[model samples]
Target: MWLPQPVHALPERLAQLIWGWALAWWRIVYLGAVVLVLVLSPSSYSRVGRHLLARRMYLDTLPILLGFTALAALLSLIITRIVVVTALSYGLSRYALEMVIRVLVLELIPLTAAMFVAMRCAIPSGAQLAQLRRSGRLVVLERTGADPVRMELLPRVVAAGFASVTLAALSCVVALAMAYFSVFGLGTAGLVSFTRMFGHVFSPEVTLVFVLKTVFFSLAIAVIPMTAGMYDLGASERRSELGGLARMFAVLLLIELVSLVGNYY
Candidate 1:
């Protein structure tokens, strides 16, 4: 007995999908490796190169840092208040600080920072790179003896990664301060207990996981959108943007899940 045509087509479609996904991941890894080499190489830091990197870093980081910190502070204040009030109502006030630290500082702030940078910097940079590629400017630069990847793309990636990490770090501090104030209300009476609780929550293993997760989040925000944009240059602008964002978010979600499992499970 012969199988239906639809059944055969389904397997072919599945294989195609798997192949495409694997190829996309391979390209992202390849690009990331190339960028890493360029970043570490001494020759990539000529005077002009240093200037480009510095300028991109400034553009990526300073302008948005204040706004992001304020947003993080507001969210931290609201969440800490809710957690403290709820914990007090349940007579579980002892756990409120721990919960606040774990939820806001460990999980939410890094993810938020990554997304914010992706939107503000990564996605647009990727789109610009894609346009340059599509318009053959990259080839023109290559013919002129300029390494387009080194001179154009590398700084953007580095700046974006730095921005994500910086934003997360700053926001984490803000969140912790907010958590303290919300729980203790402008007094030093809780200082010792707060430090003890903070230390307890950030054990070596947990601390390692948190650091790794934030780093991975920064990497994803830095790399994924650019990879998607560069490789999907044939697609329409809106579609490319959406696709890049979708892939970035998917990687971020996977990273978050892994971190959650490592931290809690």
Candidate 2:
């Protein structure tokens, strides 16, 4: 039986979509491997390399750190107050601190920090890299015997990773403090109970999961956009940006889901 043309083309379209997706992921993995190798190679960090890394790190980290910290503090204050009030109203005051810590420090802060870095630094850096590649600047550097990956991409990747981790850590501290003040006021009356609850919430297994999740989030934020930008797939610049952002969000969501299962299930 002869099928309609549209029906016959359906499978082809699906296959093409699958292939494109696989190719994009493969590029990400390959680029990540190259970056890891460069990072581990001491020869990649000569005096000039160190200067590039330091300058890029400063550019990536300092502009956003204070603003992000302030925003995290405000968000922590609001969330802590709400959780404490709700828990108190429900006669679940004892669980309030635990919930706040798990929800904010262990989960939300890291994800928020990753997203913030992605928006503030990673995506823009990727876009700039794409522009440079498109304009043949990367090729020019390559022709000059320069390792563009070492001089250009590595700094951005390392800086984004550091910024994400630093932001998450600082935000988590702010959140913990805000939660304590929200529940305990301006006194040390609840200090003993708070310490006990904090310890209970951050058991070894939970702490391990938290750390791993934050690291994965930072890695995704650091790597995905650059991969998309560096390896163009016959897409327009706008399309590339949108596609990279979507992929990055999907990976972040997957990491969050895995962490949630590890923690709760």
Candidate 3:
């Protein structure tokens, strides 16, 4: 007797799922190799590469990163005030500094910075790269003996990584200052106490985790969209662009979830 349709399809579906995961893993490995080659090649630091890097840094990264960092600072100031006021109202005023440090510096600021770069920079850059690839421009450049990965992709990824770290660091400083001011006002009276609290909260272990989390956030913001753009199954530029963004954001969220689990649990 012939099997039922559902049973007949089950093996095929399982095979398809397994194949998809294999392809995904292969893409990740290829992306990692591309990044490693770009970073390790001495030719990547040539004058032309330096010019490209500067252009990406000044034109593409700095302006938007600064504007977003400022916006994050304002939002952080508001949040700091709220946290401080709530802690005071709850008779948990002693924990206010620690709460601000944990929430703002250790978590929110880096995530916000990564998301900002992803939305404003990474997706658009990936879309443009996909469009160029769809138009065969990258292949044309390759035919000229120029590595498009080095010439075209490296600067953008490097700039994005730098922007992520810069924005996160600056926003953390702003948030810390705001937290201090919000809790203790402008007087010098609480300076010693604030220093003590900051030191206590940023023990070596917590500091190490914060550094690693920021590094991972920057790498994710820089690398994921480019990888998706290069590897997604879509042929059309429009479809590739959308697919890249979807995959990039999904990866970012997964990284964030992992960070949360590691930090809290």
Candidate 4:
């Protein structure tokens, strides 16, 4: 019968469809992200918000955020500079800023910052949480009537988020500066037009979208690993490790897809 062949082909076809759909929806997610973050930003909220702020972004998270912010800024400068130089060398300097804007700011920086944190902290945080769960530490705390939210989850979650946002913001600043110098070359001459373009692309709506997207990007990085870690608790160590990485990467990709859709559509 042809049934087995059809069944086998089904998964492949489904995968292709999913992948295509993901690409289509991802832009919308990016466009929607900024607003989400701004609305949920610490300044936007009240005292109750402070607790959420601590949970999402706090001192413990500061170190990683600082490190990532610096890293992202440097990387943005290097990458943008390279693109500009390459363009000018090829006698296509006109395309430099626009290409840099599209590449570094619109797509690469946001995604890159997310991916970096996901790899560095998200995976490790998952492993740590999963190990705690496997060791029954989470349960034991419960026996003693302890709060996992404060002792364990909060710190890591906060760190993951702050790091994500810090890196993202830093990268954006660097990208803007790199674009400036690359285009205007040590002058304030392109200030008006460049600023206009910046304003054009970063409309209040776009900014709102980007804020939402970045925050969610942070959330995904933090939450997915934590979720996986929760499941891995009380499981085999190897299984927990594998599960953490798998879940973190999966969540990162899902976030990326969501942002993409929100941006374009």
List the candidates' TM-scores in order.
Answer: 0.92, 0.94, 0.89, 0.68
Question: How displaced is residue 254 in candidate 3, in Å?
Answer: 3.6
Give the per-residue lDDT of model 1 (tens digit) for 1-265. 9956777698899997798668767877998898889889999899999999999999999999999999999999999999999999999999998999999999999999999999999989998888888888888999999998887889999999999999999999999999999888899999999999999999999999999999999889998888865664353556656766787889999999999999999
Worst 10 residues of 3 by lDDT: 235-244
| Consecutive 10-residue window with the lowest summed lDDT within model 4 | 23-32
Q: Relative to the unseen true structure, what is the C-alpha lDDT of residue 73 in candidate 4, on a scale of 0 to 100?
A: 66
lDDT of every predicted structure (CA atoms): 0.90, 0.90, 0.79, 0.68
- Among residues 3 or more apart in sequence or in different chains, the pairs in candidate 1 whose N, CA or C atoms overlap within 3 Å are none
For residue 175, give model 4's deviation from the true position in Å: 2.2
- For candidate 4, the clash count comes to 39
Per-residue alpha-carbon lDDT of model 4 for 38-115, expressed as tens digits?
A: 545555445644565575455445556667667756766777788888988999886677767766776678777877
Candidate 3 achieves a global lDDT of 0.79
- Candidate 1 achieves a global lDDT of 0.90
Clashing pairs in 2: none
Candidate 1: which stretches are off by over 4 Å?
A: 1-12, 232-241
Error of 4 at 6 (Å): 20
Q: Write the per-residue lDDT of candidate 3 for residues 1-265, one digit (tens) a residue.
A: 9956788799999998788667765765687678778778898999999999889867667778668867877887888788878988999988978888888888888898988987788767776777777788889999999988888788888888888888889889888887878777999899999999899988887788788888888887787777656653764545545545666678767877877787778
